[model samples]
Target: MDTCYGTPNRKIVLLTCNVDDMTGEEIGFAREIMMKSGAMEFYTIPVQMKKSRPGFEIRVVSKPGDADNMAALLLKHTSTFGVRMQELSAYALERRSQVIHTPFGDVRRVIGEGYGVLKEKLENDDVCAYAEKAGVDRKTAERQIYALLEAEKQER
Candidate 1:
């Protein structure tokens, strides 16, 4: 992929296809396959197709180098006969991961900063582990962890 000089981070490719014959489970499996094939984004949009049949328009974004593999996976895993690909430049935030210490356990937090703003979130796997160990739901565990972080900020 060519380096983009604009606000976007880099150049990428978008692959799209339309299909209506796959079941929900099949779509899920196709999504997993595309993700494993290094697709940066895999999503579907519902559309009304010919003869009033409902179908899904699958869209996948990938690095230019991975577009061929992503397209191949989509062709192999989905009900579509052909895939369309387009090159695009995309914006992305700078991101990093940190281990957050809590009373229950250590959680991996993903921190993103860019364009004069910053955001943080605990990794889902870590949150799930924390929830199980602390005997709380995921949302509750997240709240508690954020509360602890806020308290720590207040102290310092």
Candidate 2:
């Protein structure tokens, strides 16, 4: 199976929580729980509640598929009873992953283009191995290798 990342239509869902004001350690702990539950981005927004009491508004951003699990995580960690989830869609990009030959050996790079798309990034270990095998500098090998991928952008 091919390994890939950054898929098109990858929805970014925001999971927000309303909780009582607390210390940094408490907030950070909640943040960690939210992140491990599959949130890609996590943050806390400060808010002033009734009687000038301070609190935090926790927001968790993740893929659309993670909406349910993430919402549950927020509710469980922050003791929030309800959460609001919204869908935001946009065109991503067209990406293609390919393995090409280089003077050094083998290097990997992702080719991405503009709706849902993804490609691969070159692995340093792979490049080094090839460079060693080919008896060439890694930098030179990288330049020669990346040129092929650049040609793809020109084709556009």
Candidate 3:
């Protein structure tokens, strides 16, 4: 498939660690810090640790160069002593941004092209703003925006 934007050439690094000593609030703070520090994605999975004690497995995906920084952040913010690292080839879809007119106003969307298919995602802030302006529920505003996008797509 032809990319609407230029192809990306880079690798993705995944950093994972298990933390059993930190509280839930610390974990949440770590997640935010990771994102702000350039982590592409961050999440936690609930798990049972030694003696069946509750714990969490934190996962962070980032650019190859940012692995060490993210790992340090994980260790510094969380109680984890060590982090496991892995490198993987990353294939990203070409993406572009466009503003489309909707009943509420103009909204920006991120459109991605991959595998001969095009997909678009509305910005969350835009959806919320539209919902408030239109005095409609969030879902209703989202649906109206999607319908407008679909109609525009069909016109192309």
Most TM-score-accurate candidate: 1
Residue-by-residue lDDT tens digits, candidate 2, 70-111: 887777767567788877664456667667765556666677
TM-score of 2: 0.52
User: Which regions in candidate 1 have their CA more than 4 angstroms from the true location?
Assistant: 1-6, 151-156
Q: What is the Cα-based lDDT of residue 49 in candidate 2?
A: 64
Give per-residue CA lDDT, model 1, range 1-156, as digits (tens).
Answer: 555344987799999999988999999999988887788889999999888999999999999999888888999999999999999986777899888898778999999877666888889988999999999999999999898888989999
For candidate 2, what's the RMSD?
8.7
Model 1 lowest lDDT segment of ten:
1-10
lDDT of 1 at 33: 81
lDDT of 3 by residue, 59-116 (tens): 9999998988999998899898899999987667778999988878889999988756
lDDT of each prediction vs. the true structure?
Answer: 0.89, 0.72, 0.89
Is 1 or 2 the stronger prediction by lDDT? 1
> If the candidates were sorted by their TM-score against the true structure, best first, what order would they fall in?
1, 3, 2
Error of 1 at 144 (Å): 2.2
